[model samples]
Target chain A: MGLIGGSYAKALRRLGVKKIIGVDTDGKVLRQAQEQAVIDEALCGAGPGLQAADVVICSVYPASTLDFVKSAVPFLKSDVLITDATGIKGSLPEDVQRLLTGRMEFIAGHPMAGRQGSGLGMSQAEIFDGANYIVVPAAFNSSGAIEWLSSFAGAIGCGQVVQVDAVEHDRIIAYTSNLPHALAVALINSASYNENTKYFIAGSFRDGTRVADINPYLWSDLFLANRENVLQELAAFSQQLERWREALTVADAQALQEMMREAAVKRKDLY
Target chain B: MGLIGGSYAKALRRLGVKKIIGVDTDGKVLRQAQEQAVIDEALCGAGPGLQAADVVICSVYPASTLDFVKSAVPFLKSDVLITDATGIKGSLPEDVQRLLTGRMEFIAGHPMAGRQGSGLGMSQAEIFDGANYIVVPAAFNSSGAIEWLSSFAGAIGCGQVVQVDAVEHDRIIAYTSNLPHALAVALINSASYNENTKYFIAGSFRDGTRVADINPYLWSDLFLANRENVLQELAAFSQQLERWREALTVADAQALQEMMREAAVKRKDLY
Candidate 1:
């Protein structure tokens, strides 16, 4: 089981979800989750139990999420509600909804909770505590499905459950999540790779670059999936940096101080 | 009483220093430090007590540090050891050494410790605990003076006392300290200034941009004083970020992953 899936299973189990079934390609991971009581049953693929379930939550990579949903469509019960925990939604929700038609409902969800480390061993139910959960509801989705997902999120200890359209979700996430990760990676790479340089790193450098220690495969997929938004945000950040660079180059103390002061005041308001 | 000076006084008091005479322009701040037992005596300006002191540590702004040191030159005893806690060296150490040639010794020091908040109210002796203490030894400095400073650093609870030349110290700090602060400010300003955007900021965003809430006047002086080094580091960082932008633009998943993975591995080593 992956970190997000395992965490979901643990949270669901704590909420007394009856007979939770985990699906994973890796048998060893599935067995580990079962042994840890994160899941009651482990299935390599969709089975008869899938058709009997009232709700199915798919936690998979963004690249494979659409395919996973498509494959699971035939095995779902007529009244079953389906949701996904993918980072980038794009048009996947619309595509999945089109495929399901009148058979099932699909609401796209993203749990803005993660650890630098991954895998079943790193999963904890408390990871969701004080975290933000976003639910992207398409025009075709029913209000009842949205309400149910909101209640589920609250029960799992999510501090906030924000409802927004898929387009807005991707746009905001590009700024709040993807852009920061990109900056962290860039900051880390910018440093000269030497033991001497490592010795001098202090608290700010460590905290500022923490996200650089990322799951590359997962992040790359997420970045490419939301390519347009990420690029736009990246360009905006670069332009912001360029303004500071200009001030520094010209030795404009007043301009530099004003910019830093404004940022400081704004940042203080956020916290 | 400023944060760094007040913290040093607090730590020195705990170490049973016989007396710590604090010189400040503001009488209220000096009184506050005196009332807090952070200093044994507080003066509005240079007094007879300053000349009587065996050692003096100038904790003032970089622009004012040289002037402060110069003003104290006449009051100091021939054997008195002089040092400063200035953010930027920028030939200040050389100038001060030249001014006090054969009369006193000036060793530049930087305490790698700070809080987002300022003033004596936020000062704690424990701020120095497990923090780095860098001593920039000048060519004119004696081994005995360096040894004395090292012991002083250890007594104040500095986890490590690193010895380096002034040039090396400034060069490394440009990358380790100044660049991170610059990036943080730029990152904070990069976000669209809106209430909705503020609400979406999470842990990584908060941590990555914490230093953006900076003392602008202090930072501006530091940046300008170390303009050449800061600009060089900033340029290097921009080049590094540009490489990532290129990789992302072409959708080079493998290259992106490799960059992230390398940064992650290197960052892991630091902790």
Candidate 2:
């Protein structure tokens, strides 16, 4: 398991779940999980380990998440409920709806919490503490299924459980999650960086670009999967940047002060 | 005295300086700082209080820094070593040099450290712990003065003391400091923000936009003071942002991942 999956496994273990069957391509992580008691068993990929699972939490990249569901559907109990911790929900709800058979159900979710690093070593049961969990309920999903997923999120320490449609979820995520990552990447890759930059980096530079140290494969897939919304949010943000450029170019002190004041008020209000 | 000035006062007190004199327009803050023993004495303005000082630290906005130095120049202590905590060094070195009386020295410095909020209420001596201290040496400054300022920064808990000229300081800070603050303000004021968006602010959004809760009066002047360099860095940042937009539009996952990987490497290298 990776960061998200391993964390779910760890948090579930802390909850004293009857059994946690961890799966990962890395044999060492699985073995470590078993030895550390974070999991009772370990599997290399989706297999019979999922057969006894009443509820499966798919914590993988968007495409791999769908792939895992398709592979595990055959082995899972007919009435098992499934939810995901994918970064993007674009096209997932419809794809899952078409792939499902019998009584299987899939709810899409996005956890609004993450650390800079990845892998099981960075995983923590408390990562979800005071985090926002966005649950995307599709047309076929029942209230009962949604409630189960919501309560599960709450038990795992998510402070806010927000319900929104898949489209809205992607849109909000493009602004809140994906846009920030994209900007962080762009900032870290900017041409202004030079040899002496290391000595100049402070909290603003450090915090603003912390997510630039991202897992490329996962983020590449997520960004492409939700390309349009990301571009749209980028355009909105570009417009905002242009406001700053214009204000600076003209040396309009009053305009600059007013804009900064508005942003300060908005930022303070967000909390 | 605001956050920076008050913090220096607190830090100097922690260092057991013989006397700590604070000045501010806000009478309430002056009284609070005096009663808290953070400053041994408080003055409403740069009047007689600066007459006895061996070193004067002007922690005000860029323009106000010049004004304060000019106003305090008329006071005694002709041998005073003046340094500032201004965000931008554009035009400051020459301006201070032109304003200096006989035997006075001004060494422009920036503390590559800050926290959210301002005012003496938020001041802390340990804020500079392990922070980088940038000392911008003007033509008029002597090596002895720079050494004294560097050691003072060390005594206040800066981990790294770097030296750069005023113009270079502005250029580097445009990237390290100004660009980040501008980006943060723009992100917070983006059009996508709606009433429900508050539920989505997580570590990425929160950390990325943390500086948006800034001091408008201070930042607006700083941004304009370093307008050319700030604009140049913004252009560089915009170009990088356009790379993301183009890659996403063309569905170029390979390019996207490659750029992200490079950013990850660069970000990791910064440490």
Candidate 3:
């Protein structure tokens, strides 16, 4: 059980989801989850237990998620619902729905809740509190399945349940999540790379660069999965930064102040 | 009095600096400072009473700071020490020290503490409790003046007292303060400017763009005053971001992950 899986298990338990069975490839992780009571039942792989499961949630790396779904399809019960907590949804949701069309339903969900730390030790049920939960439904998804997932998200303490198409979800996430993470990494790398430079940092720099402390393996997969949208956002951000750079070069005080004022006014509505 | 001036007055009072006389162009602000006990006395302009003060601290906008120093010089005592709490050095420190050398010392200081809100209503003495206080000494500053300013910074509840040359101070602050603000503003402007987009914001986006909600008039002056250094930082940040963008474009997952890992390791030392 990793951080996302363990956190989902804990949240499911809190919502009175009995008989929570966790399946992971690692035996040590299964044993740890069992000892911590994060799961009532732990399985090394998909087995007969999957036939009895009404709904299966896959929380894995972005690239591995589709493979996990494909492997579990053979063992899943007929008419079962399959969902995932993956950051980027390229065409996987539609592909999975096509693979299991008549037998089951597949919907993609992304919980905007996580810590910089990883593994089961860092997971907690309350991490989902006041966080957004986004559900992406393809054409094959039924209305009843979407309703059930939305209500389940509410039960698990998600402050908001947002429904959007997969393409729109990935596009918005490229700006809101991926862009910020990329900027933080770039900002951190842009520093002087000397120990003494750290002493000059203040709260703004610390807050601006917090996401630079990231899990590289997971983020690289997310970035590659949604390369086009992320690239578009990167281009937009660089263009805006260049505008400010030009303003500063010419000492265009009016242009600089106007940009700051507009940003200040727009940022107020975010909170 | 405004936010920074009122906060400094309150902090000085906490350190038992008796008879704090505040001078402001606005009479209403002066009356508010007097009513809130932020200052023992408040005056609308530089008066004859300034000749009796042992030290004078000017907390004003960057462009107006030099003019304020020039006006107060004629009424100051022979050995009075003058310091300013301005965001940018802007050659004003050297000019002021040159004008008053062998008569009074002008040490430029910048307290790295402020709130998003303005005016005396939002001022609090505890704002400086754990914040940094930078003392930028010019060529003409005496060792005794630097020593006194450092002790005074500690007395006023500053956690760290950093001493740096005026040029070095501006260069570092361009990275630590100005660049972050510029990035924040650019990020906010780069958004689609749609109200619906705000719903997708999470902790990272909020933290990365918090400084976007800044006072335009004040920040414009700071940016123009230190244009060269800020442009240099902007150029460096753009170059780093371009590197990441190129990595993402080629689907070079290994290169992207390596950069992220290096940033994560470097960010750990900031805390």
Candidate 4:
């Protein structure tokens, strides 16, 4: 459990969620959350407290998410709906829904919100304010469940609720999220920085590579899990980059300015 | 004159400079600056008003810096010291110094400060408060003159003042400013963003691509003027991006994680 888990607890609480049960392997963090009133019942793992949970929000690193759910399944109520805060859906929606198979409901969600810092210490409910919540629905999920999840997201401070299929979710995320991370990481790594590097730093370099200081463990999994889409976006980005290279190579001032203008328009409109 | 020119006027005013002579071909803008107290004197192109100046800070687009200096030469006092706020040094220092040839002092300074928005409306002295001011010195420059320019930058609210030659200045800026702008423009161009793009937008994408809303006229000149160094940095960045692409292609999670960790460390250290 990290920033996402702690944030979900806070946001859910704001939605008047009663008897918030926090589950984490780290008993120390769980105890701290309980003391801070982030959650009412802090569980070391899945316990009898989960039996009363109408909704199970599984927030973990992508790699550990499936295992956590499988272990908790026996303790969850049969009517409980499980929603995940995974960055990339990949096959999580399908695999988890298949495993549940009418035993419970699973609707995967990716809250398009985060900060540079990670861990529960950095978490806050306000990160979700004006953020988009992507609902990745499996075939097994009822429309009613999806509708309820959308409203749940809105109630928890999300501004937009978008329901996309797992494939579309992964594809969209690969472009908007993963590709930007890859670029940020690559851009930062490309620098041959000495102590003098900081003296030359400005807004462009600072903001452009801010995401390079990432949770390596989580992001690497996100990159690999959505490999196909990430690779495609990377290729597209490379081609666009090559256009800049070609223009600079020939010192084509007019062509360079035109390309930059188009990009400026796109960026302004998109953002 | 654009953001850099207006900002220099503002900063020099903050330093208690009694007279801020604003120069521009745009007569209306000059008059507006005078009216708004941004300038003590508004000179249309080169005027007799420039004869009383001790120092001239030439803040124009990189492409026009040389021409502006040439036109202003006759009007400027022979003992006057001149500096520029061009993002790229290129041959500006050498060319300007050679042209002046003891007629006036020429010291090039690139205050590594900017915003996404351009023009006089967005100019502020606070932009330089913690910004790096890179002094690009030519072979003919006096040690005392360089030292004074460093202090001048400090007086104008800039933080660190780094003295580097024209070649080194161009090289460092290619890495820091030009490369990041190239990545931002390329990243924005890579996306086929529809109206739905706004819904998917998050901090990482937003911040990373913020500079994509560039001043095409200014940045294209910066990129082309510093073409060789910019191209070199772009190649290095492409190679770094290729590493991410390769790790994803094979679905190598551990390799990806290691690369990301290295990037995270570098980013943390450099920033």
Best by lDDT: 2
In model 4, what are the clashing residue pairs, if there are any? none
**TM-scores of chain A, one for each prediction:** 0.95, 0.97, 0.96, 0.96
- Report the candidate with higher DockQ, 1 versus 2: 2
**After superposition, candidate 2 runs with Cα above 4 Å error:** none
Candidate 1 residue lDDT tens string, A1-271: 6888889989998889888889999999988888878888888876665776788888888777778777777888888899988878899998888878455899888778887867888888888887888889999889999998988889998877888899988998888888888888888788554666655666778777888888898988998888888888888888887887888899999988998888888888875
Pick the winner on TM-score between candidates 2 and 4. 2
lDDT at A99, model 3: 69
Residue-by-residue lDDT tens digits, candidate 1, B1-271: 5888888889989999998998899989988888878888887876677876888888787888778777777778888898888767868878888888455888788778887767778888888898888888888788988998888888899877888887888888888888888888887787544666654556678778888887888889999988888888888888877877888789899988998899888778877
DockQ of every predicted complex: 0.68, 0.88, 0.73, 0.77
Clashes of each: 0, 0, 1, 0
Model 4 chain A: lowest-lDDT 10 consecutive positions: A94-103
The per-residue C-alpha lDDT of model 1 at residue A187 equals: 80
Q: What is the C-alpha lDDT profile of model 4 across A1-271, one tens digit per residue?
A: 4798999998878878878888999988988888888999888887777888888888888888788778878888887889988888888888887667345889888789998778788889999998998888888789888998899888989998888888888888888999888888887787555567788989999988898888878888788789999899988888888898889888898989998898888887874
Q: Looking at model 1, how many pairs of residues clash?
A: 0
Q: Is the docking of candidate 4 incorrect, acceptable, medium or high quality?
A: medium
List, residue by residue over B1-271, the lDDT tens digit for candidate 4: 4687898888878888898888899988888888889999888887788998999888888778788888888888988999888888877788887677445899888788898879888888888997998887788888878998999888888888998888888888888888889888888877555667777879889988899898888888788888899888988988887888788888888888887888788888874
> Candidate 4 local accuracy as lDDT?
0.84
CAPRI-wise, candidate 2 is: high
TM-score of each: 0.94, 0.97, 0.94, 0.96
* Candidate numbers, best lDDT first, in rank order: 2, 3, 4, 1
